[model samples]
Target: MTHSLRLTHLVVRVAVVALLAITAIGATAALRAEAVVEQVPPGAARAMWVWDTSNPQAVVDLAVARGIGQLYAAVPPNVGSSPQLAQLTQLSTLARQKGLRIDALGGDPGWVDDPTWVVDNWLRPAIATHLFSGVHVDIEPYATPAWQTSRSTVVRKYLSTLDTLVKAAGTVPLEADIPFWLDEVPAGKSTLDREVMRRTKGVTVMAYRNTAAGPDGTIALSAKAVEAGTALGVPVRIGQETDDLGTDPVEVKQTFHGFTVAQMEVQLDQVVAADSSSPSFAGLAIHSAAGYAAMTP
Candidate 1:
């Protein structure tokens, strides 16, 4: 090769190597960016079954300090109560400041049955609060064989009202609280099926009650719920507990209500794995912020 051509070839080789190094660096950064899930701080994200909006700042501060990502505040119905409004305003303001997402515009179903009441009372204020990122409708009419015939109708009406209410609430997302044992409910399947999920933004499975023990019971409960929800292709947030079930023996406390540290760890690990295993396991939300952090593992 001529001397000039030889120098040009060397320069080209150097440029190629430099380009490769830069590409490698970019790829590494991209991979690291997607590693957010791996670093999820323990009990950092949760969904609380809030009875009241009292002490908004304290709870929000606690959650933010602990690295919690989302907050699903359950707002109970109070047609004429001014405290609800004040509490919601406080929560809304705090959530915005802390950069936390609030789910659920209203509280539960009994309060929401009157479609007009739900619209005029619960929803309009949700838009005004501006603290909520989404709306969660806990519309439980129970799961009985006799109710099956009317179940679909009620659910459809509820979802329809929700669709209208959410639109009125502006850009907030929506989630409907479905029965925890939806998969096993043979007759009430239609009311809580993928069809319902397809029509809504998301779903929360309340997989426990105040009187339960053993993670095994709750785990089995959650597994079935998630499995059914996964087939629907939507986000399913698992609801576990925080309260120490009233028990006398201290040792029983360790295994009380199946939310033991080991059980929680196992459940969370399974949850993380399930998220990878299926399209439905969107994220996890414990029954309360307190319960989540208090979990053993």
Candidate 2:
């Protein structure tokens, strides 16, 4: 290409980047202008998942405005060369300045079959960027077909995968997402919940039920894992769902969808009341940054 054309190309690239920045900043400013910043309890641990990197600055702005303490920002399956790298780096810089912890969040059940590939291609490169505070993996092995057809075999493979992550993570904290009922799935002498907590620095129990109390409620479902975390001295964050989809939209109790954010706060306050005293309890984690932002105020 000629020098003039090369210069023009650079100008266009700069223009596109500047436009995106302006748009994200505009969205953040509008959100701040329209919304009353919700107060989170002082020193309370709170986190939200950020799956959409299309607007990292906007996500960070909301996190700061909302008093959220941590962010589990999603990365592409192969961060070694994913185009999302630049945005993620921007997010990390902004989040750190705002005193928030951001973890590289990436996982898939299929990853259980090849831990080395995941670590070499995704986890290591993401961490090597020095952009993330920790690693949060949501490898739901139970979601795979082999889990049903060959439960024992899949269970062992899942354990091996966790072992690989623990080693790969080294000093960087490694955390995993497990269903609240994983304690029922035996892993040798102990349950999957206990085994996972034993291996990782922390675990987020996806106890998605909206209610705080009762046989099938969030607190009740999370009790076992919370107890295990305490015994094993592992941090445990209880996760809640917020997506609009539900089996019965009108009577959905599994998620905060359709309900006002205020109502969900009331239930989560009850969760704090019940479990905040536990040394293992590490506050609450909303499932997705986008879903939480979309909740009715």
Candidate 3:
């Protein structure tokens, strides 16, 4: 063969091999992702919020007994401390051994203004300990009185906070807890819920309602979040409130305190059935570990 022809032939062969290698890598990644998804039982992503880390073993035992697959637990802000770090490491190891995913949980309205502080001071240190699989921030900006006075500004700040957190989290997924009413709030040309979901790895919508199937129930309220998440290829976890808020006027609409655990399960079943078509419908997250334990079925 002529020298020119030989050079062209070699180049073409190299290109073909490179393309095949790339294709193989892509296929392998897709299969791995599919396997992970399959491992998660459908309609069985039972999760709960845990605040106390005093007795990690007790928490792990309870989670195992309840068939919980995930726990959003509160890690101490002083994760730099040896004792706090040790506690988290122990808890994380136990939870992992029992086939449970544990995420570092934190939240505050002030976090909107300075999310980097949370990332640098708490998230990074906790993650460095290799104790958390992800970060779950429950920053309810609406809780701040300033939200009423400067609604648009507050909304923008909240979105910026999520952006900052996502960047700082690096490979660690960052999830946010958002209110169900976020769909009703306008942010720029889109809704607040859409903006938040666009930035975070996943979202847990606090669809804190007593009913499940009615127009104003949890399922209906959570529909928008599920739809948005599905469109964005992000997972949406529907959160139900089980804690007793007593007679507090502010928390009147937040819980199913009077309902039995069986009733709550029935509601959750309805929610799962309603959102079953959405690939991003992650599953249900009960309000709290202690509260759920106290619930009478």
RMSD of every candidate to native, in Å, equals 15.7, 10.6, 15.4
Winner by lDDT:
2
Candidate ranking under TM-score, highest first, comes to 2, 3, 1
Candidate 3 C-alpha lDDT tens digits along 217-281: 88888888888888877778889887778778547566877776667667776777787667887
Better of 1 and 3 by TM-score: 3
- Per-residue lDDT tens digits for candidate 1, residues 1-297, read 010100110000011212111111112221111111123423224445544456576556545433445666756444235566677667767876866666643544554356777767776655555556667776665543424576655555655666666567555566777756555433344534455566666666766543233454444566665676667656666665555555755434323244554445455555555443545555555556444434332
**Pairs with backbone N, CA or C atoms under 3 Å apart (clashes), candidate 1:** 44-68, 104-136, 212-257, 213-257, 213-258, 214-257, 214-258, 215-258, 242-291
Pairs clashing within candidate 3: none
User: What is the TM-score of candidate 2?
Assistant: 0.86
| Top TM-score model | 2
List the candidates ranked by lDDT, beginning with the highest.
Answer: 2, 3, 1
Which runs of model 2 end up more than 4 angstroms from their true locations?
1-39, 247-251
lDDT of each: 0.52, 0.77, 0.72
lDDT of 1 at 259: 58
lDDT score at residue 82, model 3, on the 0-100 scale: 52
